[model samples]
Each structure stands twice: as C-alpha cells, then as structure tokens.
Target: MPFPFFGDDKSTIARLLSTLPQTGRVEWIGLRPARREQLLTVEEATAETDRHLTGDHARPKPGGKRQITLIQHEHLAAVAGFLGLAMPLAPGRLRRNVAISGLNLLALKNRQIQIGAEVVLEITGECHPCSRMEEELGPGGYNAMRGHGGLTARIVQGGMFRVGDEVRVLEKSSA
Candidate 1:
C-alpha cells in the first residue's frame, strides 16, 4: 500500500502507525490551548469564552477559545526534511495531539472534522510556526514549515478523541 505521512520517516511514527490494525479512522481530531486539563467542544469552549471578559486570565486562559486544526501526516515528514533534521520514528515531532494520515490536511485547510464517537471540530485556520519551533529544532526549524499548510480550528462539539479513531469530514471544505 502507498504510505502518506509527511516528513522524514521516523521509526516511532512508523511503529505507531504499524500498530494500527486498519486505516478506517486514520485521521486524528484535536484541540489546542486548552487549559481545562481536557479538550472541549467548540460550542462549550466558545460559551465559556463569552462568559468571561476579554483579557480575563483567571482560569481557562484567554487563548483557549474554540478552534480546530488538521494536517496531513506526510507533510510532517516534509517539515523534517525541510529542516534537515532527519526526523526518524519520532511520533510527537509534529506537535499535533492527534497525528492523522490518509487525509488531505493541506487541501482541507479551514474545514470541519467530525468524529462519530465524540465531537466535531471546526477547522479555523492554519497552525503557524512559532519560536517554540526554534526551541524544538536548532535555529532555522521554524523556517522549514513556512508554507507547509497545517491548520488551526475550533471545536464545535466536545468529545473524546483517541488514537486510531475514525474521522469523517462532516462538513464540506470552506476554502
């Protein structure tokens, strides 16, 4: 079969992917900046944001507003290659809570991904590189993913997402 994970093939990622029995729900749905210990759906997260005043840094933090994100696994390897890191077998290098393969994350930027068992995530926008990336790599790491196409989205519904769980694009691509 044809493999679709991006970046340099890390043994860890390959091992993780191999552990998956089948490729049914090969995509991983996720949430970010969640300070609540666990991830929340978009509606709930948004409601919480509305309840708090702007710049309220009390509990949930201001940045944890509802959002969604998606990226093709293959693209992640491309990032390592671009960075010249020789990313081999490390699963978490992508920094994505859920690593999804077999889906066109780059093409589906700013779209919604629905999980049958739990919730729906509204694809907000691209998840850009930050200084943290530089910290992860050496110096020019951030420059590697300049335009690789990772998305940032809000969760519309709250639910549990696990590894190997199936994901369906419940909504059409917005852009």
Candidate 2:
C-alpha cells in the first residue's frame, strides 16, 4: 500500500489501511548517545519538533526523515526464533529508539502517529537493518533482522513521551 496512490478517492484497500483503530503502547525507549555506542535505555524522553530525541546523538537536519527509529515489540520473538534463540532479544540490542506493541508499524508508513498526548511523528520509511547487527547480535544477526528491522520517522510535533504512553495513528486531516 504505497501512500501516494491512496488519496481521497477511498478504495477498499485504502480504507482498510487507514482503519487502524487499535492503539499501541510504547514498551521501551533508547537513546544512542553516540554513533555505534551502546544505546541508553530510558523510561521517558522528549522529542524535539523537526529534530531527533533530546538525548539521542542523531542530529538530522530539520525535516530529516530519519529522526527516530521504532521497532515492533512482537518482532523481538520472531527475530529470536530466526536466530534459534530461546529468549527474545532485548530492545537495545536491535539499536532502535523505541519499541512499540499492539499495532503494525508498517501500516503507518507515510502517515503520522501521535505518541502520548503531544509527540507526533511522520512515518518516513522502513528502518532497514545495518551490518552492525552482525557484531551486536552475533553471526547471522543481520539476516535475522532483515524484514523485522522496523520503521524510521521524523518528529512532527515534539513533546514528552514515556514508556507506557499510548500511540495512535492520526487521521489525514488531523495530521
């Protein structure tokens, strides 16, 4: 479901894609203090409008599409299964900034999601797994995270969001 093709005309597939009524919850938040450095797990963080998270080292230019990274909590076990692990990998190990549960992040692509009450992020693209996954998760890690890598976003409206905050997709008119 590419976004550009879904306009006001309202096709059946477009309606289904836009009908994400289930709300998600923020399960974890991590900040990359520096590039390639271990992520610092936190209970809460502030998103700066048109910028990255307050403490995250990534300083993307204004309106940059990759300001934040998010992964699905459900995918943790899937990735672990692919690696033949008994336990799910920790959120920090994947290097994503936030871990969300209860909603399909893919469905939010090219849309805007409101985190908590104030933070709004535009789903820019998929957050593809990097080569570092091999070093971080041991051999075959990169391949294990291929499709489950998650999504990338740009901060649209900045505000504080905690680990337990609700995340919901905003309607096109609202976004």
TM-score of 1: 0.57
- Per TM-score, the best of the predicted structures is 2
Write down the lDDT that model 1 would get.
0.51
Instruction: Write model 2 residue lDDT over 130-160, tens digit each, in one string.
Output: 8999999899999999999999999999999
Over the stretch 41-148, how does candidate 1's per-residue lDDT look in tens digits? 121222122122122222433344323334566677787787775763233444544456766555444445665466566655667777766766668777876775
lDDT on C-alpha atoms for all candidate structures: 0.51, 0.94
lDDT of 2 at 134: 98
**Backbone clashes counted, model 1:** 25
TM-score between candidate 2 and the true structure: 0.92
